[model samples]
Target: MNSVVTRRNLLKLGLIAGTSLIAPRLFAQAHTNTQEIFITNLHTGETDRVLFYDQGYYLADGLDRLAWLLRDHRRNEVGGMDPKLYHLLFSLQQRYGQQKPIQIISGYRSQATNQWLQKNSDGVAKVSQHTFGQAVDFRIPKVDTQELFDVCCSYRQGGVGRYLSSRFVHIDTAGVRHWG
Candidate 1:
């Protein structure tokens, strides 16, 4: 098979190579507060492994990329994502030390989308943290939902919702609480 190397493909290859080359150095500096996470939005099949924090600073471009990946798929809107939410995800990933991406069932929600969901759903909150980009419904691949919920609740940093039927745990940057 003939593989044509277009400019786009070349750029992609370069990015992959560059990331691989620097990954060792990046991970080496993980002790210096380098926070990274891999996320895959299940709704849109969008994914990225972003290094969002370094030495107590959140990288703007990385955060934007994450928000883009985590945007409202229904309405195609990108909201301002709270940094604390990213921290929560980072902590979860670090605790489990998983290589698989966090599969996001839901992320930011536009007001219209939230209201539509509220109207159609029985348990979706009328004032959801998702509207403010402060919550995420996600699950790790091959990881049990009960274990995920327990780990999240252990932090006691935010609201945790365990949806057993859906097999996703919702963590929000609201006051500490848990509900199934």
Candidate 2:
């Protein structure tokens, strides 16, 4: 005797098959537990690797800008970024899945730069995250801006501010919430 298959069972079988087919490729290229990034202090002429680990990334001395910027006596204030920020950035990078490095428009901001931004842009927050070395402004040249924002939003690690108007996203570890 032939048995009749239920519609629900067929749908379930199809979904399982589809997932099984796609799962391997996804797992093969899954996000690495750690990611390595090279950062250049254009002002200070220094270079360092920013390593992103599971919980967050580590900011090395070379990555820190206070020493470099202080040497040049520039009005730029540089400090090690919060680890949460790095993790957030890493997650965003993973979504892109491209080896293309991220371009930082601005990372740590000195009081002078903050003042300049305040005067220049109406959108600049008076009490910005830069004051505490918690904010990062960056862009991935070859990646889609909207796609980047969407990925960042997914993590909800901290504060993911999408600045489509300015074409750079602002990421911070601030517990406070603000996004555009």
Candidate 3:
């Protein structure tokens, strides 16, 4: 047996095993269809349609477009959004099966913006996931927001909040919790 050949085979198996450890979702995934989402950033009044994931893989350009869209608008600062956040959005969109854009009230927030929001807003958290680019507050047009909140909660994905007055559902990757 050639030692080099054996080493090559082991390296291949190791790669396979390492890939196994990545992309394990907290929930069961049925990613058979192309994952696409239409988005509208309310603050920036910008819109983008992204085919973020397809064939069991997340596309980088699509994610980049998403992160760009999710940037803090107050100071025009961009942040690297956590990809898990996209997977959650994809799953939610899949469940709704709607073709309409996800109307975003909030996404990535700079610490300065967050601090300002905390001072001015009633429920803004000091350590919000938005600062970490791990959360989104959004609503679909013509969709019942209460029902959307219920749908977000049903997934058991992470922190889910229904702000009725604001008419948006907030989801985040930091905590497994639900709130109003």
Candidate 4:
């Protein structure tokens, strides 16, 4: 009887075990659904859907182009925004499905855009998290913007700003308690 241990056998064993370990992760990735957020434009009365996946967030199908129109600064921007905020937005959609789409007046603002906004509007915060891609300005389409502000205040995730004339509520991941 002759028996020889070879590299081929070891390779085959490693391949089988590695595939077994990664199979579940591949399955989960295939099964996961995009996070859904609905934005309602207060002035236009238009509702739109936005989807967020694991990648650097891209505009989802059926999303209002106006809501995500900040100037691109992807190359020079920070990206560690907490996923919890996206989940919170999804929860809001679930809780208020019947209402008009919650309008994303602003999301993921670029530093240049934030600077321009700060220069133009007294309402814009000097140290806004929007510049860091960690805040959003939103409102409910056809619903009173104040109602949206009230809803955001209930969550207590971060900063909440009520801008009545601007017709939007701002939510951030700053972990500070504020409303204006």
Q: Of the candidates shown, which would achieve the greatest TM-score relative to the real structure?
A: 1
Tell me which of candidates 3 and 4 scores higher on lDDT.
Answer: 3
lDDT of 2 at 164: 83
The window of 10 residues in a row where model 2 has the poorest summed lDDT is 64-73
Q: In what order do the candidates fall by lDDT, top score first? A: 1, 3, 4, 2
Q: Which stretches of model 4 miss by more than 4 angstroms?
A: 1-34, 40-81
Compute the lDDT of residue 122 as modeled in candidate 4: 84
TM-score of each: 0.80, 0.63, 0.80, 0.58
TM-score of 4: 0.58
Global Cα RMSD, each model: 16.9, 8.6, 7.1, 9.3
Candidate 2, residue 65: CA error in Å?
7.4
Please write out the lDDT profile of model 3 over residues 128-177, one tens digit for every residue. 99999999999988788899988888878789999998789999988689
Kindly report which residue pairs in candidate 3 clash with one another. none
Q: Give the TM-score of candidate 3.
A: 0.80
Q: lDDT per residue, candidate 4, 110-169, as tens digits?
A: 667677888987877677687676777776556677787787888888888888988877
Q: 1-180, model 1: which lDDT tens digit per residue? A: 235557779889999999999997887676359889999999898888998888868899999999998899998999988888888898888777659899999999999999999999878999999999999999998889999999999989889999999899999988999999
Better of 1 and 3 by TM-score: 1
Clashing pairs in 2: none
Candidate 4 yields a Cα-based lDDT of 0.64
